[model samples]
Structure formats: structure tokens, C-alpha cells
Target: MTETAPATATPGTPTDPGTGSIAGPSVAYQNWIDRQSRNRRQVQVGRALILIAFLALWEVAPRAGLVNPMLTSYPSAVWEGFLELLAQGNLGLHIGVTLLEVMISFAVAMILGTVVAICLWLSPMLEKILDPFLVVGNALPKIALVPIFYIWLGPQGSIYAVAIAVALFITILMLYTGFSQTDPNKIKLARTLGAGKRQILTKVVLPGNVHTFMATLKANVGLSLVGVIVGEFQASKAGLGYLIVYGSQIFRMDMVMAAIVILSLMSVAIYLAVQKAETWLIR
Candidate 1:
């Protein structure tokens, strides 16, 4: 037997050496990738254009007397507020605190969610018993629990707990939904081949839920941030949420807007990290 040298072909088009016909690379996949790339670039450009237009309108509106700067701050005022924060040297400290809380919450929620999901998947009876409780828990207004958490965990840790609570239900729901919806046919096929529960879970169910986990992470990222901000709003002395609260009290709309912009950027950063992870995973 001889191993033939590997054949080289253009992306999307491949040739089989033995049959001298086209084969290997998938044309549809290549085209889809091309289209997706173009769409992504277009979306980014559109977002930039919209942002520019908004800032321009904001700047002109206040200066042209169409709107009040004190009520709706312009980009320049926001920038000035940011600079003041930077000069005060607590800007990074506050951001770092918030990011830390969000990351911790996101991590804890993801781990616990995945574990709980797997446990539920392993026991149908247990899942049935707890499904109602889960539905009720998920349905509960999380923000309403902030005061309870503050009293329970104290100011130092309540923020973290609040963040976790905000995201935990979503994570569990997404993961459990993924695990439950895995094709029954696939499980049965594996079982018919003498595969046990553990084997089926590892080889069939788990592998198929990668995308679900990625989606859950993306959602968890946003939820975690919201939780953190809410926690900070009522708990933390140092964070963007605290800054917004403080600014609002002082009637410094510019500072409040700056803090909000930072929060938005943080959310985007975490979500983009999830997207990057997904890209690496799919590749």
C-alpha cells in the first residue's frame, strides 16, 4: 500500500486524486463563510456610523439650544467627566471592582449551571421534581431580591451574590434545555450499541451541546453585568454603578452618562469575549 502525496486545491474546490474529480472542501460552507464575513463587516460599519451620528446630534442639540446639556449631556461633557474621573484616579479602581464582581459572578454561575444541568439530565425523576421550583425561581423578579441579598451576604459579598443570582437561572435554563433536547434517537442508537448512560452522555449528549453552552455564556455575560450593576447600585462603594448613583445625587449628568458608557463598553467586552471563544470553538 502507498500513501499518495496530499493534493492541494483552492478553498471551496477540491479534487480527488484517484477519481480525478472534485471532492474535499465544501462549496456551500466556503460561500457561507464569505457571506458571513461580509455581513459582519457591514454590521460593524453601520454601528460606527450610527454612533458617530448620535454623538454629532448630541453635540449639536445642546449647543444649538434644541436640548439642554444639563439634561442630556453631549459627548464633550461626557469626555470631560471621564477626564475628571481619570484625574481623580478612582476611575480604573471603580471599573476594576465592577469587572471583578461580574467575572466572578459569571464564572460561578456558568460552573454551577453546567453541573446542575448535567445532574438533572442524569435523573429524569429528579428533574421532574424540581422543574416547578426552577420555573418559579426563574420567574421571580431578581432585582427585588437585592435587599435580601444585601442583608444576607453583607455589603462586601452581597454584590457578588446578587450578580450570581441574576445570571444563575438563565444559565441553568439554557443548559438544561440543551441537554433535554438532545435527540432521543441518538441516545437510543448509542444504547443499542451497548453504550451505557455515562458513555452516551460523554460521546453524544455533551458534544452536541457546545453551541448551547456558548449561547448561554453570551447571555450570562450580559446578565452577570446587570446583576453586578444592580448590586453596586445598592451595595458597593466603588464601581461604575456607584459612580452613576453618586453623580446623579450630585446632579452631574455628564458623570452619570460617562459611567453608563463605561458599563456599556464592559458589557460589550465580555460579550465579545464569548463570541471569540465561540469562534475558536467552531474553528
Candidate 2:
């Protein structure tokens, strides 16, 4: 008799005819994972190349004396400056102050803006009345108002004012857009089902516009940071902006560059955090 292969089976398990084992992933699945890994690696390589190019230029121009080292400094000098700031703990303090301003302003703006948007959404008459005011506020140069804020609320007041200025218009615009763009068919369907206005807003409109709200939040993160930095430029005793001004005033180009780098890094960090939160919220 010819030898016969015994069919192997596991209780509660199925086998693939080609692989003989159920534990292995299909080729399509493996290909998808490989493609994703390759894409991730490419992104990483691209980021690394950009950073290396920036640093290389910073190192080359100064060392080659093509630029005035005192005026522009070198990448090494800025790195050393960063180390000094880290050792002294001033960097942390400065960053903390700016973060506090951003958080407070953002929170206040979001709450107030949402309330206003909701009220307007509920009452067309109120929206009509407030439209001009909103338009004028949005048109005004918020930076110019910093001086008035300093005078009225004192120097620290600029911090709150700037944050509000940055966040308010964006929040209002986004929320209004979200509320206005809600699907009319959904509204009609909800009404036909005997849903109240409040129910329509709470159960239908709000959820429908969650994605838009998340996008606005991401945009607000950048705006809030800009507001904080602008406030620092106007009147803060300490912040990344203050550090830049101080360094430049003293002709410490390396310190100025370091502070600029810190500000850029902070912005990136805030942006990334917002993006992560948006992803979670949307999912």
C-alpha cells in the first residue's frame, strides 16, 4: 500500500489548503503590512534628510566664514546655547509660562465661542444682529490691540488677550460653519420622527459636525501658540519670545537661534498632540 498523508485538524480551528497551517497570514495581508512598513520608513528617511540638510547648512555657512559667525552663529554654537539653557532650567520655566497662557486662553475661547455659536444657531435673529460685530472683530488686527491690552490689563493681560484674539475668531468661524452645514435631510427626517429642536441639535447636528470640530481644534492649537508667542513679544517677562528678544538685544546670535529652534520645536509638539487627539476623537 502507498503511504498516505494523514489530514491534520485542530478542534475549533480551520486549515488553509495552500499553507496547511491556519496560523500563517495570507499573502495579501503580509503584502499590506510590508507596504505600510516601507511607507513609514520612507517618511522617517525624508524627515531625517530635511533635518540633516538644515544642520549642514547651519554648520557650513559659519565655519566657511561665508556668513558672519557673530551675527548668524553656527549650528554648534546654537546647540551649546541650548545645553546651557537646559542646565539652568530657565528653558522649562519659560515654556511652562507660555503653555499656561495657551491653555487658559484656549479653554475660555472654546467655551465662550461654543456657547455663542449654539445661541446663534438656535436664533437666526441673534445671528443677524451679531454678524457685523463678528465680521469687524475678525477683520481687526489682533496684534495691534496688544498695546491696549497691556495698558488696560497690565503686561500679563496681553497674554490672555492674545490667546483670546487668536482663538475666538477661529472657534466662532468653525462652529458656525459646522452648525450651518448640518444635513438638511437629516434635520427633516428627525423632525418627521417627532424630534424636538433640542433633540435635533444634540442628537443629529452636533454629532454630524464632530469631524469639523476636531479639525477646528487642530487649527486652534497653532493659533493659540501664535497668540502666546505674540503676547510674549509684547510684554512677557519670560517666554521663548522673550528669550529671542533678549538674546538679540545682547547680540548673542547663538542664543537667539537656540530660542527660535525651541519655539519651532514647541509648535511642532503642540501640532502633533492636537493631531493625535483629533485622530482619537474622529475614530
lDDT of 1 at 227: 89
**Tens-digit lDDT track of model 1 for 83-111:** 99999988999999999888899999999
Candidate 2 lDDT over residue span 84-117, tens digit each: 8899878998888888888788788888888888
TM-score, cand. 2: 0.87
lDDT at residue 46 of model 1 (Cα atoms): 100
Off by over 4 Å in 2: 1-25
Question: Model 1 off-target regions past 4 Å?
Answer: 1-41
The numbered model that scores best in TM-score is 2
- lDDT of candidates 1 onward, in order: 0.89, 0.85
